[model samples]
Target: MRTQALGGRPRQPRGGVPFMLLLAVLVSPAALAQGASRGARLFAQRCGTCHSVGEGDRVGPDLHGVLERRDEAWLTRFLESPGALIDAGDPVATALLKQFNGIRMPDQPLSEEERAGLYTFFRECTAKGKGSCKPSPTQKPGTDATPEEVALGRRLFEGTEALAQGGPSCLGCHDVRGTGVAGGGTLGPNLTFTFARHGDRGLTPLLAKLDTPLMRELYAKAPLTEEEQYALKAYLADASRDGSRPRKDRDFFFLGVVGLLAALGFIGLVWGPRGTDPRAH
Candidate 1:
């Protein structure tokens, strides 16, 4: 009698493998390629601010041949929690921190799948040799923006035009010079020189993600649209061009002061102290 398996089926040979496992193995390369594409986008959106795959260095070290220099396990651990490794005194992590001017790499909350995708991306880049896989540079509006776009940006910054995503306007938190007589809000830092400070490489990812603590919280749900980002960047570039110069709106200021005095006089006339009439005296 033949040996039987469950459900009255004949038992397979000892060397036989499961069909699902075989199918997964066959399809893994395609899956990895897809994951690598996603990883490239993630790198542009997040990692491009500091680290570059092929470029020499930014705020962090170059990542070319990073996979060859470190094993996948170590890379995964470091990527997941760089701070933890640094605190625990891992020699490599400590050396990297010291090498990069003590700028600690933040802990990334990436899933296992995402991590694998990044590994695949790194591996593919390594295969392509050095300087072959640089992230595409972000296009800044700078001197290339049309006058209409700059005007739209000003309107957007001043809250005259509504943001498409229903997010709060820039005027609520930050101030740029030449906005108006009253300027903008004070909750955030002055942004008159933001473009000068960060330039295109730094500002691109910042505007794309808004990853700072306060901004992340504020825009966690309501992010800026691409058009809004473009417009705002254009306005900021224009502002930064003349940021160091003195305000040129003398007439506007004079008008504002005059208007304020006129309003005060009207208020005083309406609610001034009562005086005896000359006729009664």
Candidate 2:
């Protein structure tokens, strides 16, 4: 998008060196370490069977962009016990079962921290995707958030300002914009990591659910419009993917350190060989 001139107007001069919006490609070393720590191991042990980052699907669907497709609560529920949702007439789960030849997904029990780490794995892939998304030179980065998009999203999230309808903003149930309560209201589960969990597929369904029986039963049918959905989605998408990239020169230092320590500990155990206590000798 061309930079807006003064008075909030977009002015593109002929041959005015039309600039491409380049974000601060600053991914901190800490974020990479955090991503690879527990999440990397958890993904390998739990999700590695059916999924690979760039590889296609196996028994089940490919999970590469799952975080972008579904939201956190949906993923948590599905993972905790797939049968509950599949049997209880959940459309998405039903579709999944059919897609996978009606084979049931075994229930998985992941600690909150473990699930959070998996979220990190999903986020890393999405971050790489964002970096690689190439919009046509003529087209604005509409789907992806620019700084201006983020500002718009933030405003839409907080209800201090009003939207088109009498309907309130998203700040009602979920926490966003890093304000109010850290996790927001209790009627709904915390949405802090939702973007990392469901991603696009998950967020897309919520727009339809704005008028669903569940919403009507719960919130007296407080419907969200298409614009509201777009704005809120933008807000969530922008906020959720925030992390720093590790320095390219130095990679896997933490893992190397951990591996070295583990090797030393193993050597110590073997230092006392079978039937021979070195201290005794």
Candidate 3:
């Protein structure tokens, strides 16, 4: 048969057309899935720290249904150079900067292929519904905080729960919105927007090393556990979403009273009793 086919275009392979068709049908879906997967990874690495696809705004606007809100062409231009658009005073860009509390969505420098992938990922997220889109493995799950995490974080930050390693409590020098009247001290900066301002990329490293002049001394011997850091980060992230606000004044008088009481109790412990001295004859 092969000898005969050599004279007549090799008579084609039997069932060749059907086999090729089958291969295309089997491979196409996998190729599409792979492309979308790649897109998701790119989105997480480049855009996810500051923007959420469905879960509400982070440091920037939520990108769910973004293509629906803004045309792909416009989005392309904006994503490529957000600062340029803002500088040119594009009305929408200006409004976005204002709406998100003056935090600019940083420009994402992407080639055409990467931009296409991100666009694809955003579309997939919109189709999946709010909070349904699972990020690629490369992404951190910090885009949204669970209620449990926020509550635990709150307790940890307020010193109501003791830290594992006896590190300095955040409440000793910082304040948050719901920390209450006597809750937080004011020696450090208010952390209302610290997470929002720094996001995971900037904040995670800072927390891990505890390298600041004061933090090094304070937490050097008693570093925060990973769990503790995550919990506190969750709490601060929740507060950051609340945006900037005035810190409530701490009840310093109560603190002074407590300190005085503690001092007297220590003296009593060292001496014989509350009314007695160690040197009594």
Give the top-scoring candidate (lDDT).
1
As a TM-score, model 2 comes out at 0.35
Give one digit per residue, the lDDT tens place, for model 1 in 48-97: 78988988988988998898999888988899899999999999999999
- The model with the greater lDDT, 1 or 2, is 1
lDDT of 3 by residue, 94-124 (tens): 9999999998877757899988878787787
Per-residue lDDT tens digits for candidate 2, residues 1-281, read 11111112123244222221110111122234434445665665566666566566577777777877898899988887899999899899999999889888778788888888888767876788632322112111223656665566667667755655566666655554364545343333234344554444445444434432223443345555555566666666665555422122122222223333343344464345545745454
- My TM-score estimates for the predictions, one after another, are 0.40, 0.35, 0.40
Give residue 117's lDDT in candidate 1 (0 to 100): 74
| TM-score leader | 1
- How high is the CA lDDT of each candidate model? 0.67, 0.53, 0.64
lDDT of 3: 0.64
lDDT value, residue 281 of candidate 3: 67
lDDT of 1 at 38: 71
Candidate 3 TM-score over all chains jointly:
0.40
